[model samples]
Target: MILVIDALNKHRFGGILDEMYKLRARVFRDRMGWDVMVRNGREIDLFDQLDPAYIVALDGSYNVVGCNRMLQTTGPHMLSDVFQDILCGEPPLRSATVWENTRFCIDSERLKRPGADRTVSYAACELMAGIAEYAFNSGISDVISVVDPAMDRILKRCDNAPYGYIGKTVQMGKTKALAALSDITEERIARIRAFAGITGEIFLEDDVVADALAESTPVTMPVALRDYCDAQIAGACTDSEREAALALQRELAGMYRSQPSCDA
Candidate 1:
């Protein structure tokens, strides 16, 4: 399944975000030999602080298997900020409707079986579908992604090849990288779905998503109190104890509901 997490709701997806970063470190820094930053086992950069949206792919166990980062082209992005050489003298493209995609990687070691080819996995197609669906629904018309030739070939094999190129390929460290633009439309999404044999929505259920957010979020004071209440409720053996725990939970819920809204 796919989960879309943006800046406003990122606090809910902390665990998934950590897994994605560690996966990026494994794929780009360790496997691909990219000169990206890997601090304390996480491959993060300045762009992460810009509050970009992330489309993350999860397996049956809800573990993060793949992810891609999306940033508005009008803001700080890879193509304009770090990959200027890929443009080959051409001006970097920027627009409100166009978004930049970068740091696309999959957890190959965990997701790929012993004899499986990582490029042709279902996780790749699912991640692409998630990106297309999320962007199309969000009023984004185009996405320019910084990718290597291997990714370019994988996209073509999956029948989701880029419609146009931004510039010539340039050598970055040990890999040849270039920019490719893809249209975000229902037709494009449909084509990917057809290839991937996905019939219904690939997103997780609303309740499951909420639970993931609530469980993964960093523990604050309120959260710590809630955890204690939950533990009390779970350990209650006598009927009276259970009733008291339930009443405490209800009181905490009421208190939470009565708090002033931050957005207000």
Candidate 2:
């Protein structure tokens, strides 16, 4: 199950740090060619230490497969410090209760199988839902995300979209789109939590155990179906292989499209 721990540096970091570093290097340095600070086969950065980030997905072997980062607007953040040049003015999340979303990466290489797919999606939903619950309990009402149109769709699918615009997007590397809370709902949160089969006193709105999964941590998929994902990741197997991957990706993309939003 996806665990959402605060100040996770003290604990969860130990379990997924290495895997996260490797995944970052592969995607940022090797694949995407984004300049990164690497030392001794590890990607090190100032943001890692300062940001109150969340690492979301893990495999059965406890390897990290997908993750995202967030920072409060208090200190030097995306608005005043980093991407200011690309921003039109003050960051939308600057004046209110909001968490700045950044560097959301999915280790597609690791997430090639069915197990990986379910785990990644589940983790994302849980993390977003958990954040919403935390915000509600803490008396904070806004969860801000700076993303592109593509990512905005993804967040909406998982149920985190902006209520209004705080700042407009100019140009930040790519066209950046920002979304705020108000879009988070109790019903959507319950649906996502139920799907993930998370059981705990999460300080959330009430819901009940409905099935065998009431008290258990849910796995994204049955073990048997992962073989198909594994085969696809290993490379195209036949005429259908490529078609299958494309179709699956489109399906996943559609999930994001379901909840559309304007700029944050």
Candidate 3:
């Protein structure tokens, strides 16, 4: 199935959120045994109310499938509120220039359906691509995702680790580990598509938007924040800090290039 990607305004998102909660309850609570709260067959979190999120993936009839919740680092996120131990100790929470990519999970029952692979992969790729576009356009410098260690291996093999990994491996479950990524890359994206057996181009189709998304335009940042990032990248900071800066910069650049205008 060809996956569709659409940005929902806050009003439209209410429905998506409802669907996502049901899906999450099914996958995490009933299936995976996550010990999460489920009410009327729906799972939710306090952060759900506080964070601005995007829903990804769809079922055969075009219902929501796999979904990932995201929040800017300006707000409390995974590294800050939940997975602080996952960071290998480089200020697990960045003050700025970062976004927390969280709540990435797939609905397995939905996955068992025909053509589910393409739908899931397309949704994942589309969401990542769209996030990259939004980040660059919004002047955000980086996007961060904390994932399981096994998945991190897959991601590293795919060459998607261009942004860098600052988090350490922590047990989410037996055979489940959590790690973090600074950004997404073309090579990594191509690998993920291949892994899911998806074949086709998924770049955005608009040149103006692509250019704005891809290029490193001077965005407004506080002088101290900008200098700190530069200094960290230049090795004036600790090794971990340098790594964080490098990852953040790479993520920002890759996202910028993934825009439709930069596709050429």
Candidate 4:
């Protein structure tokens, strides 16, 4: 499932964005050997301070399997500021209709396991489709990105090729980088959906689905804990004693709820 997480609605996701940062740390630092800042196993940078929107891809269990960030071009973005060297003296493109895409990555190790197909990782393609849909709906027409050669090729293969390029392809970290432009159109979205075998909307639509799922799903708490709580409530002599037992049960349930949905 795809989630559009931003500063305003981030509180609803419960550390999902932190999981995305951990994924970025593994992909950019361990896998790609990028010079990035990773504190407590999470990768974060100045661009994140700009309050960019994140496209987070989660598995059936809500594990963060893929992710990307979108920032408007009128402000400081990766391509315009951090990757200014790629522009090679040319000024970065800034327009209201255009946005910047960065940190596009998928958890290939997780995808290679049982439920996912390695050759055509649907999570990656799903992210692309999510970007197209979210951008078009948000009034964004195009996006600028500093993509590596491998990602550029993947974009082409997925029928979401960059419409144009700007500046020289310079070496950035362990990979060569070049600025790319991708137009958000219906045909492009349709092509991506076809390639990824997506039949319906991939978006999970904020906390509505999450809240509904929680409400419908049956909770199977440990019988021992349930019995203890029941016995305590039953033996209580005063109303305050009964309230205390109930509060304890609720507190324990809340502890479980606050735990990470799945490890990154």
Candidate 5:
């Protein structure tokens, strides 16, 4: 399943985000030898502070398997700040409808299998589907991705090829990289789905996410019931009375659990 994380709700998905950062550190900094920041096993940069949205793919255990980052082109982005040379003297494209995508990676150690075809990995296709669905839903018309030539070829092989590109491929560290633009539309998403043989929805619903998070944390008692329980405990005059109050509290807790969640 895929989970979309932005600045506003990142706090709600702390564990998943941590896993994503670690995966990025492994893929970009250690394996690819990119000169990106990696502190305490996490690859976080200044753009992360800019409230960029992330599309993350998770396995059955909720471990992050694949991920990608997106930022508004009108604001601080890679093409404008870090990869100005890629533009070859032209001013960086800035628009509300176009977004910059970068930091795309997958957890090869955890998700990859020996002798498995890398060209058609489930995690990779899920990440691509998440990006396309998110962009189409958010009124984004296009995405400009900074990717290496290998990734560029992968995109084409998956039928998600870029419609246009900016500047020639330039050597960045040990690998050659370039910028490619892809349109965000239902047709594009459908094409990816067909290629990946995915028939069902790849994105999890909000209520499903809430259930998963609730299962991980301790259940919180309702404020009024908690206050009543406290009052009962404080005002108890005998051991038997206190026991009765405690039993009532347990009953109330059961009732609360029986009630449907508001998020549901």
Candidate 6:
């Protein structure tokens, strides 16, 4: 349901990511009218180039249904660089243990479809739970996001309410925006799980999922091997070196192509 993508393995899931970006364009630009940048049908900005970790949601058919972006507070981020007004009079938060979570959105159309694997409410809760679990496991002490009052209430209702707030709420676009502070704790995660009736793991390891998919889909390779081969090809300084690197890539491509389909 949830796939955590960082700078490393993102290349392996390019199609899914395109859907996520398009979803962002719809939510932030068309729906919320936040004046976000949408280019070539994908919403992207400077923050995206900073290599922030992205948490993405997928449905039964592997459609990108939800997503969230996380960035270390010690570096450039939305609240610190773009939406600093949310800080009110105080300085922006900067810490190795605190991460700024932004671009939190879900695909309204897809999640509401009939016979979908997850409803919108459950997907949202799962995403929240995934974030909480990821943060707790990563040694992050806190996560912050600039959200409005309605979102605040939703968080509270979902049992993942922010323990504290920073700065004051002010009108940003259609609603008031404020800095929301949430502590990474087991209790919060438990409450979210209880509310959504979600048990077991919320996050799927990217590598493991890729490996499984590779087994089922011929011509698809695991991300690690693909990345290593790509690096070798890019770093080749001579014709022989280039052919050597290309040999492994060609052999694997043929091997994968020869595999019988699961239905077979």
Q: Among these predicted structures, which one has the highest TM-score?
A: 6
TM-scores across all candidates? Answer: 0.78, 0.58, 0.59, 0.79, 0.78, 0.80
lDDT string, candidate 2, 1-264, tens digits: 343434522232332444565676776567655556655455545665573655355544445666566667666565556556444664434645656666666676666766554555665665566556655565554555655566667765764545554455544433444543454467656765775676675321112211222223233223233333333422333335435654664454465456455463
Candidate 2: list runs displaced more than 4 Å: 5-12, 28-43, 51-53, 114-120, 137-139, 174-188, 191-264
Candidate 4, residue 129: Cα displacement in angstroms equals 0.3
The number of clashing residue pairs in each candidate reads 0, 5, 7, 0, 0, 0
| Candidate 1 vs 2: which has more lDDT | 1
* Model 5 pairs whose backbones collide: none
lDDT against true structure, model 1:
0.80
What is the C-alpha lDDT profile of model 3 across 1-264, one tens digit per residue?
A: 222223333332233455677888887667666656676566766566564555355543445667776676777776777766776666665645677776666666676676664454455555455455455555666667766654455445543453566657665543444646554445445555665455654433333322332233444233344334444443322335435765775665566446655234
Expressed as tens digits, the lDDT of each residue in 1-264 for candidate 6 is 889877776666544555677899999888887767776567877787677888888776567889999999998888878777777767888999999988899887887878888889999998898888889989999999777787789899998889899877877766677889999998988999999999887777777665655565547766677666655654444446546766887787788678887788
User: Which residue runs does candidate 4 get wrong by more than 4 Å?
Assistant: 116-120, 212-264
Model 5: lDDT of residue 24: 94
Write the number of the candidate with greater TM-score, choosing between 1 and 4. Answer: 4
Model 1 Cα displacement at 24 (Å)?
0.3
Q: Which prediction has more favorable TM-score, 1 or 6?
A: 6
- Among these predictions, the greatest lDDT belongs to 1
